[model samples]
Target: MATDTDFIHRVGDLAPALRSGGQRLHRPLLLLWALAQAVNGKPRQQPWSAIRASVTPLLATYAAAPGDQAAVYPFWALRNSNLWEVEGSEELSLTSDGRRPTLSVLNERDPLAGLLAEDHDLLRREPSVAARTASSVLLRFFPDVMVDLARDLDLTTLLAGGIDGALRPRVGEPYANRTAIAAVYGGNGVGGITPLADGILSVYSDDKGPYDDRRVAGMDWIAYTGDGLAGDQKMSGGNRSMSTYRAEQRPLRYWHKPHGGVFTFETWVVIVQCRQRWGVGQNREPRREYVWILAPVPSPLRATWPEEVKEALAQDVADDLKVHDDLDVDLPPVALGDPQGAMTDMERYRKLSAAARRTAAGRTDRSKLTKVERYVRSTAARQAVILRSGGRCENPTCLGHPTELTDKGDPLLEVDHVHELSRGGGDTPESMIALCPNCHTLKTRGSGRQQLRQALLVRAKALHRSFAGSQGEDEKRREPTTGQPL
Candidate 1:
């Protein structure tokens, strides 16, 4: 007849070994002990059947001998030393009287409950402890396994494949931001992690993947460490004064790329010369200092030949500069007052300026006709008359719309004479019609004026015929055509 105290200690010692083998007998024993204690005052036998049923399956396969099987009874007895009634037994189906004690309740009453509560509190506070512990154990024992996984995957190829998969199905889809992928992972910090320049880092969402190849360069580690100016005090007998001046001069050059993106092998050479400096004393003379060149290796993994590579690149730039200098020496300056040449250039510029003004004015002019008179001249007024006569353009084949023919909804129509204005054709509505930008360019091309005028006349005649035909079918007679008044 072993005492309950001795049995509890023995069962407690075996608990860890059994748990290591993945057996779960202790929880059910504890639950049964709690239930028995809850019904202590009432005349009721323990619910042995329910407790046995709950825990039997868990221990049955592991208990190989009859002696091992008998260990369950003492285990149940020791755990039930203290228990309390559960408020929600009906939902749990643990008791017919609608009351039962749970292991949670028994633990609260047990003398060692404070230690158990503290352990539970610690586990709750740091849930990641279990996962971190497991990972540490695995890594300590199995370094080779992790290396094999790394070898099986080519990270760059996998990332590119993911990007291609996302874009292939949505061909021709307009990207709102073309630089989004580059901005996220192209060697810049993402979260709180400082971006490392010698390694590759990437992120993969369910729908997209972005990555960057970071390379260590000389410029990344360089720093400016010297100061140029210092303050000094001078004493002459009892009189003292302070003066500030620069000393031990050295030219400083700070190198930076205009666009921060991946730099290739040939792109890292930058040359700078100090143009000007201030803060030197009045007596001290200013002079141009040394020219500086900065070059960085594009890849961290490769060794750099900094001196040789920088010299080669600088010589190439010097050669290009020499070629430009030689060309400037041979060109002659234009003589002043070359009226014939000046007039030719002015005429060319005037035509270009006129075209530019027409484009700027658009299709409409709503400026007070006063402003129109000031800026809109002979060719523009002629164009306006043509737009008003045709509504759009008389050319049936023309695609120009009334709204498309104006700047700010003011008409941009330009008139073309059926016969040249210089050759006796009057500037009247009948002789001119509207033309859009495309047609106007065609009419003004070399030797095409006569053909363009004929084309416009044909379109105008067709339009008139259509209008006349529609009017003839109506019951009321139409108004007569008003020819231009002299």
Candidate 2:
């Protein structure tokens, strides 16, 4: 008996015998048909003759090319996907390919075949699972004709919402430390928001940071402060990175710190709303910052998000979450900043470097050039790189990578130099960029180091210019210059 996880795992990862690529939908179509049938109370196992007659015409008309209704293979070969079973299999002779027998022998035998009982039972009990699975399959394989296919399969009720991956987090558990959290949700380990390889952030927060971030005493909402410390936070940088997750339909990996010990992975949260609140600057000047209101959710399956919270947040927007006054000392505003922020970390570094180039000089020692240079050993460039990354690695060609934690217990997104410092590369932001351990390894020691370095240089320059092209220009015209003091 396969468990729910097992059924879900197998169906999602089906390795159909795709040696014949002519009809790509054979196995998936067959599985969808079976799952829909399960929801409709169809018998789990049925005779092959009946199965053939039922699905042949549909496959021919809907899924297959002309005169290519090869329905026999899925019935026999689908067992290879581990979601089906053939009755009286002990007496059957197999083909040389070890997948299925000739269609003629199957016609004579008239064997019973269908979804395994355990799978069928689970599908019947949890129709949403069936719907979610069928919905995913249709979207993945038959997107163009999905609506018609769903109607044909009678999968309307079972598929109320599509199921993607669940937001990965063992909620309500104490993480050994923040580093463990970074390892789970890939990102740079330092900030409240970690950028995933997919260009989104996993926002981490606790009282540990400068901002007054915390959980509402009894509510499942987090009062998160947007990234920035002075001069009225702008809708740029980390704040912009975290705020867009809601519209992107992404879930946030929100981590909370309690006294900075054994960090707890608070929950998977959605950006409910953000409001401008008053805050204090490093120099005790009055400033406004973005405070994001995050509502906890069970998963990324949007259908499961708490509706009441949505209603409350929407209502809160109508009523306006009050701004926190700087003088209050205890109170602050809940700020939600820009869809795109004032400037990215890379931009900030460039501006800082440009401002200081007269006093500061680029490295001129070309005696010991190597493929990659060590970290600049400074926080200004490193912070800018990590903040710009928003926790994800910055390499454009990095299709995906493992989330590793650094010695500082942050996502081990190594702050490595794109150009060799030993060979006169400036130990500067333009010369340095954040990379995941895998990409860092490849850049440092891989055979294609030269090509990778050149590519990385392009990526670094692009990232550096990201903000100036949009927000920097905007900042020059409309916003004030605000960041850590030089």
Candidate 3:
């Protein structure tokens, strides 16, 4: 008899060890998928189609090679893992040894299956613990591919405490401050729409799209855009209503669409940086708006932001950074002028330099830069870098997939200096670009670092120019301009 903790440990310890001998990951992937669905509030007993809907993508992502048909191997084989069980599965033909079902059999039967009762209970009662434990296990066994796929799939919402994270306040705001912002906008805000009884966003509908169908075109990667291009027709690639929502500074609400079904985001994304954009509304009015970026809310802040989700996301960044930094290559070392220098610690040096300038000017009262002033100076540049990259790693190879989630359940990406900041590059978007940790570390510290930097700068600038031309030349609008944070 396993204790509850013991059971969970065993679940994590599961390896896809079929008697045929080669190590496989399908079991672990299936286990995590089952746990994720449990966290998402699906019923304890799930049909095979439900599992298929989820696991097929995992197979596509984590399979050793493209077009592998091994997804069904786990659907039947996981019964041995003890964390999973199947019901009504007799219709399928078993292997010659009678231990597992053939893939063809699974395809024909498509029977119902689910997590074991006790396993489901544990996951349901302690979703956070289960999510963290499972993620830790996956991270330990399948770090790079699993972590990246989890983010790209938006599967972190299970660990994210579901809708609770969306209800949380933004940085520097009181909890539930959305109510205040809603009041400010009156009927023009997210609250202006009839709230869902459960306050969760619903499915996408065809009525909402210029797209062709309402099929739940399962997303391979979540996409993000910056404030500067939020209104650009070709940039947003969305419909009029989405544009209207941004124009109003509104949090998203699930709504009807013409082609894509009733579409909705997984969470309530708040504005991080706002600016005026051209041709946003029905009348094509220019309006004040902000670009949305997903960032993990800082810790010590209390909101629906889950500690587990933050830890998992942070771990993903760490793992990605490690992969790039640990790449085996012999490259000439770039000398660090001060190996121990801390960027944050250098702020003190900046203040001292400012004080000396004030003294030389015959001014006695030297006020150091305030947090708000620093924020004002950097927000425009940050927004520009994020917008230019189209909310994905600017490394042309990584595509638009997010490698991690923000506290708000948005994509997490780091902004990097395309030109070395220490080498006198200005803190402007032109000098910076957005990158995932792996790509950033490679560009800054890996072999061929200078060539990579030059390449990225070229791509970043070209992307900016292309985005501007597509949006009727909104280039001048993205220039460093500051406004008070909302």
TM-scores of all candidate predictions against the true structure: 0.18, 0.40, 0.32
lDDT value for model 3: 0.45
Among these predicted structures, which one has the highest TM-score?
Answer: 2
Candidate 1, RMSD to the unseen true structure: 32.4
Model 2 error, position 193 (Å):
18
lDDT of 2 by residue, 353-444 (tens): 44323222443432111110111113345545665566678887785563565332455587776876444444445556789978898998
Q: What TM-score quantifies how close candidate 3 is to the native fold?
A: 0.32
lDDT of 3 by residue, 305-390 (tens): 35543443344345441211111111111111222245321232223223222222322321211211222224344544554554
Candidate 3 segments whose C-alpha is farther than 4 A from its true place = 1-3, 17-22, 65-68, 89-91, 158-486
**Candidate 1: worst 10 consecutive residues by lDDT?**
239-248
Alpha-carbon RMSD of each model: 32.4, 20.6, 23.8
> Using lDDT as the measure, which candidate wins?
2
Q: Give the worst 10-residue stretch by lDDT in candidate 3.
A: 325-334
True-vs-predicted CA distance for residue 301, candidate 2, Å = 12
Which candidate order results from sorting by TM-score in descending order? Answer: 2, 3, 1
Judged by lDDT against the true structure, how good is candidate 1? Answer: 0.29
lDDT of 1 at 247: 9
- lDDT of model 3 at residue 303? 45
lDDT (0 to 1) per candidate: 0.29, 0.61, 0.45
